[model samples]
Target: MKKTRYYPFERNRYFYGKLLTVRDFESEQKYFNDKRRMMNRLLHGYGVLTGLQVIAVDDKSVSVEMGAAIDALGREIVVPSPMTLKLSMMDGFTNNEYAKNVYLCIAYDEKDKEPVHTVANSSVRSDEINDYNRVLESYRLFIREDAPDPASLPLAGITDQTVVIYQDAHVRVLQTTPRYVNPGQLFEMKLRFEKTLKAGRLSFSYEMASERIEAIHGATIMFQEPQEQLESEYEIKVLLRADSTVNVKGTVGVKEESAILKLDDCQLDLQEQAFGEIQIIKEPVRERLMSDFVKQSLEASLESPSEPCIYLAKICLIQMGPTYVIERVEQVPFGEYVFNSSVMYRLAHSAEYRDETAGQFVTKSKVKTLAPGRPPEFKVNYNPAMSELAFDVGIPVGGGGGIGGIVSGVVDIPIEPFTKINVSPFGKPSKSFFSGEIAHGLGEGNVLILTSLEETSVDSISDMLANGERVYGGSSDVFKGSEFEPEAPEVKIGTIAYPQKGTFRIGVKLQQPSEPFDVRVRWWAYSAETASSGSSSGGGDRLDEALSALREAASAGSDAE
Candidate 1:
């Protein structure tokens, strides 16, 4: 005889919001701006309060109250706590200092059939330290469109429209039970879209984007490479299961080389469900930032007297895990700026306050001039918001002076990239910087990688760890078919700002154990030290070679067996 039970799920995941109460300031102890707690707060910390809530729960459906007019329009919309009852909010990153302020997030997977908010994080961040405060103010925090703090836009045609947008996109399901979902688990699920989507215009794509569900909460939405990208028109697809809910608006547009659909307003539902058995799956989470996650120093030209500014960006593979936070991205301490104009001005400086933090730091510099101009070379600089990586725009500062942009504390990248290497407990990550050959390319022998490693030269190892990088060395274990016994993976981990000298070697190498296994290496710059005056000519055409190498390696080992 066999026994069977029914478990129901839904198609939507939510992004929560936080609330601020009168008691918050007292509890905060002024750590919101403190640099000391930034690291812990960024990774393990919570915002001023709990995460923002987007929906309310009922017996049959999840009732959502969209943020009202003038506020919460284009940004990641979040509203004040809708309930008046005395509530003891969930306490994942919560420190009592932020008393009374309610936090929201996908509070609980409103759709999980489990009994607990297992789909969400319950540990709160409570610190009034430096690094901690900086992290809080970085990535997810934005003032309401109507708020007085500035940067918010007016919602004439956009405000009320977003409410409709939320309505058309969100759904209702039971609160996700506090259960662990492993890969390959299946369950019955349901949903109710607010608007009736057209057939052809509506399409769906299912993906197992976020591979690390055991550690964080939420899911990385996946969508199809749309047919159009610049138009206002959009398509929606309802995934029956094991797929994605893609929103297609506009035609295929070229963005960063690849064909991708673009839209000012887009919402995709890449519902990642836990396969296998829930009871057996432990949430896979890496609580600390990897060596690659650090602020690199930069030297850019400044046109005016303003607070030091830096540009940073990191490419994260969206599916690494559920929840992600930028723990730290401190600017370099020194740099140099060279302007060609007759009125040459140079500015070189370090952190307003250094010698006070823990993470490895870099120096920064900037130069501006109006003399006969020439294109500038590359340089590294830190970006507060994108803590783990950095970005260097090609069109260097020119035309001399009308005031370039300057961010106050941390700044968010304009768009979240598809892939980014987050911190992990497994080993050092981002063990290499994609450069030297045609700027950056993913190739077989051309690309540097660390399959797994146990050791490196003393200087090499220290250089990486201090910078939060992942490098792989080699060992005799490659033949043993065991762990990486060569002491280091074959890959060499490094920062975009600094590249190694001499004929640098990569870390350990290994063969893929499964079919269609893939990986990526991107071009990154964190400081002036790592910047290059030259550009990469043809790099995108090499991905196949990289994959083939890993595949062949695997085949050789399998044949030996």
Candidate 2:
């Protein structure tokens, strides 16, 4: 979009004993007038300043009220009285097949006339001749097929002479719903008109290129009951079912009387199911062991321990089909070293030991010797009867004759498949130690363990899971197996209303013998007289003052010349 450029004025120069002609005087007057017009264009811009409302006069004409505006060339246009425009006289109305859009516009015009003036002879009685160029400003109103572009209007040519004030398009399609759809889904298309239809019946029909997709219901919709009272909007719904996965392509046609209007092509895709796989491991894949420093510290503090030592273990159980498998096991260290002597003695005597070479516990003696002669050994076992995994750590205590007794501490962890658990030391606040889906079906993807001090955090995590979002925290925390990615949905569905602003456009097909309609136009006009004195008008005020000074100086120079 380009605006008209006004060049700086070159006024006539005056010198001592110089002759001035009619052309020189006319040029001098033009300089001041051009300066003022240029100021109006730059400072105020141009649009309908007030009134100029378009109202429907009848089925074939509309009336425009009196108003004022400034054209693109900075010429003021004012309408003194109301005017009526007929639809039949508008351009492109006779050549249109279905409906024609009409635009009402106004343009600036001027005329020069020579008026007869009688002059009386005074003293000398000699004939003196004088000529005057009397100019009259006027305006012209007309109707056209296209609306004028305000920024690119012709200022110095006759091609485009008017600025559009209103437009009227009889019918429009508001929206189409569910552009993407699953198999056997329903689709809807909605349309709106400027006014109620006078026809008795409206029919709907569809055509599809693919044989897999078929319309089960609403294929041919008919609205015939009380046609005189039909609404401005009509919604056509079609139930389409796809026999196989494919892209559905089709078009819908609406028929009113003898006229038929075909809509744009409709595109839809059928969604397919995506499944994931589950892998079960018979043996443990990973193990987390305690540090040597933690082990030595626990044994050293057992000399005069006041409380029982507590051992923490984090275990993850994954469900495959019916049974569950222990995928990972981690041992956590106790922050402080403490032991119960009496409790340790009972665990040391009752706990069974496991032989590392046999992969099973020794049956003959409940106690197994460690390091050929030393008494310290770990006893690990899983009991199905109680559904618990127990671990016993023993240390040797010196005696009088080189025979020492074993001091052992036991930690029993409860295991319930697919359930969360909270763990803490005795007399300490409980914290979330395990979280997983309870009774989750055979389908498998990955297991995620989220440990936090607050239990309420689970609500937000559960919401994410429900929304089909992947909840894997990181590589270390996620026990990944195998998975499949789901397909994206194809169509979106919604509704839209009329008189909207922005780049979104609506299309429509009108019935035969289309009715005349009128549109309400909204315009913003800025002028120096109507401008307010406020913070918002500060910049405008400064520009107005500067332009006023330039116009005054040009007027003074033109008068002196």
Candidate 3:
């Protein structure tokens, strides 16, 4: 069958902290008859994590800070100033801080999950590339004045392998350069000197005092001494391995919540505005969807004879925030959120036209008897205020295809079979809450989960920028196999929870969350033999017409009324 998809961009409402807001939707009065504007019914709540760093100087001062922004969809969210840096010095400094010998310092967060670039054999270390690497910061003397002219001092020349010293009438020269170095090596050094004097010339004597040199920057340092302060140019390089690995995993679970989901009102209507249509892959047939695709595609949909009731299935949901389980109640700290809902539908052909079609072409569903059966009933499990939940209701077995036959129960059909809320012989039905009573919806499948996350970082007195990827799960599909062209997911924007640090975002491995939720869904099973008309709108339509049908089906029992 030719596939057709309708996604109405209107009549959609957004969830704001468990409360539904109309700001995301247009009113029905202004809506038009847009058939292409079908509703997106699969629930979505995925979390994308990125990071940033802000610099706060001397604990209180707004020094310079920097942050890197990444997104889960593999996009670089430009952070104008992820870090705020200040060029001024500390308060107590009065030239002494600069005039005196100075030492370089290093500091950085030791978070374990950051994506690191590993260096092999002759590759340069992280300190050699990224300037922010804390390994270059230290208390080692960075500035010295042992040279005849203070301006002649070597600062950046032999950064990791040199130091200077001076005495009253003389200066000492200690060279700690190694002839050869390898990947896995360390070095150190130490030297001393005493001064000797000569008159008239204002001269001084120099000697190689101490001769102990250690490893420096992964290589052993062998300093050569000279009679006078030796002036030499040298370079010390380091090679570090950054290829790191750790375990990563995510799961969904059930827990208790202190508060109940309070759904003030949730309305879904076909808005007159039609944004456009979408095309997706599907199973070869309905029976194949359950036999093969069901276990694989956690969220999918299929067409049926029903015009409005699309058989949306397996919409997996992942909770979007921190969740706690106390006393079996799940307490999720849900913030500004977005969710997805999806369903499948198909247009039916008239009997007059079907009779003229070639039997070699398309087939139809096996019509079953509907002599008066029971309806479904259920109970509410979780709070309605949740950003999303699962809703599935099917028919029960026995009683000669009673009222429950139309629901989640198995029915015999041929050729390209049709999917239904009816439970198969051995298949399990997804549950939900619907009608005045608590029960499952008319569909069976996974509930899609979607949400936004803010990066969390540890505060430091001297360290500035502290932005990182937001850690959250979402249900959107990311096509990673397409080599010709790439696709992007919904790019959501959010404010950082903390102030000091600059904003940053990055893509994450975003996995699905395992949280269980129950919502109500009202389903109806109509006879395929029945004609489609306003009078027989199916479930509620036959209501007023079937009082005796209701008598024998009072309490809306599955088979016993």
Candidate 4:
């Protein structure tokens, strides 16, 4: 059996609070003044933080101790390490009543699950408190319904009763594991709901607006005597489509309650993952047949004796994030190579990285050139936490002089220049402007830039490499000293921003060269960490085994070749 490695796919829980309307902020004399005051209040009080605990819960009310607030006993609560708290603003909805309407999104982690304390000995009845389960069963929300004023009728009325809205059931579509999904990916869509009616039979059906998506199993589900808290699941496969909204509709029927369940407008966004940019520059070397005798001997040893030249391709993986790794690389020939063939398709070898250090990221690789006729193989090791990729490349060379039928000489070419390519993210707030010394040791070389506007996958680029076609050529933006050349340079760089993140393929093509040139680049990248629990944040025991498996795969594939 062929063993495949799987990285941990983490799904974060997202709790979106209902739109909050601060009455005073909404009724300010001036719009701009209201906005300013509201923002100041929110920042000082209701912003996102970790360790916000549930202090009290009842049928009619629920209270929370904010991360920054003091507890009832007046001692400070323990605070956990904080993550990014993204809050959505609704100032654009000016026509509405309130001056500010914002929602709170907590990227909930299961590791933060702590037993919530309930107010037990209060005067409230147990049955009514048990009915509090009704509130917990639905999409949870916490409202600070403090008396609008310390003296405002105590906000009492028929409307003041916290109404528990009831229906047949409520369904929420969720990608629990990843919180987000990529186009053309197989993902699980979990539907969590409660059976409001105890003794009713319900049938469910789902449909996606786009034809590019299909349900793995039939999309219909049936429930008999469904429990109070029940969960339904479906595996959905989606294909790449232009940025558009997809509606996942679910219809349900229940006879006893005379209720018809229609879950409409359940949106599944169709967007690509954000991938970084890659630039590849190559220095080509021409093959010299030393002598007729040498050429003849080399030809006889190999089935196909084409002059195999040495190729040195320098690649830059650029992003705003800390670091990245090259997970996999493959090479295949598109057409037959004659003795005078100008270009050879070469794919850098695959490797993995484990971010062992707390802050710094390191990249290291080893390359071994086979015989004169074969292309080299690359072995890479890197840190996964900082980033997830590294490239290893080999250049084949053989002895030129022969003494007593023994080829004698050594071609020692050092690898891992490991230059950085610093580039800005593509759009505004864009990090696209790149200025640097083209090559360190070799002095100056022309810089070529191009944009991969379309979302492309590593698999697609690997196919291009395997096909041995010229894809990175044609007109390009070139910078040589103070002068600018509109014509394409020998190499090109492609940038893919977020919503387009994927395995980026960089193709380097160089025509016949009489001498050697230098290839170099350096890059830096950063991605905000969301969840910190489990293995998502670091490189663990599986890294070594994963790399070993990769090497075994490479060896088995090479042996087959």
Candidate with the greatest lDDT versus the true structure: 2
Instruction: Estimate, for each residue in 1-561, the C-alpha lDDT of model 4 and write its tens digit.
Output: 111111122223335873444443343323443344333322222222233333213211223333432111111223343322211111111222221111211211113233443456235764443212211111112221111211121111111111111222222222212112223345443332322121223343333222333345543433232346422222333222222223222211112323233333232222222111111112111121123224453212221112111101111111213322211111110111121112212211111122333445456554433323344577665766665446677654442211111111111221222223333364212112222211111112211122221112345754676632222122222233423232222333332222222111223222222133332221111111101112343443444454354445434333111
User: What TM value does model 2 have?
Assistant: 0.27
| Candidate that would win on TM-score | 2
User: Please, what are the lDDT tens digits per residue for candidate 1 over residues 1-561?
Assistant: 111111121222224665655355534543432323332223222211222223324211122232311111111123344532111222233322221112222211112222333222333433322221122211221111111111111111111111111212111111111122223333322211211111112332232222222212222222332455321123332221221222211111012212121222343432323222112232331211121133311111101112111111110111113322222111111111112223222221224233334355444543321111236555567765433334343433222211111000101111111234434486533322232322211111222222222233346655766732432222234435543233232232232211332122221122212222122222111111111112134522333353454455435433211
lDDT value for model 3: 0.24
Off by over 4 Å in 3: 1-106, 109-174, 179-561
lDDT of each: 0.24, 0.35, 0.24, 0.26
Q: Rank the candidates by lDDT, best first.
A: 2, 4, 3, 1
Stronger candidate by TM-score (1 vs 4)? 4
User: TM per model?
Assistant: 0.15, 0.27, 0.13, 0.20
Model 3: ten consecutive residues of lowest lDDT: 307-316
Q: Positional deviation of 533 in candidate 3, in angstroms?
A: 99
lDDT of 3 at 183: 24
**Runs in model 4 with CA error above 4 Å?**
1-50, 53-205, 210-365, 378-391, 395-561
Task: Score residue 212 of candidate 4 by CA lDDT.
Answer: 32
Clashes of 3: 125
* RMSD after Cα superposition, model 3: 41.7
Task: Provide the lDDT at 12 for model 4.
Answer: 32
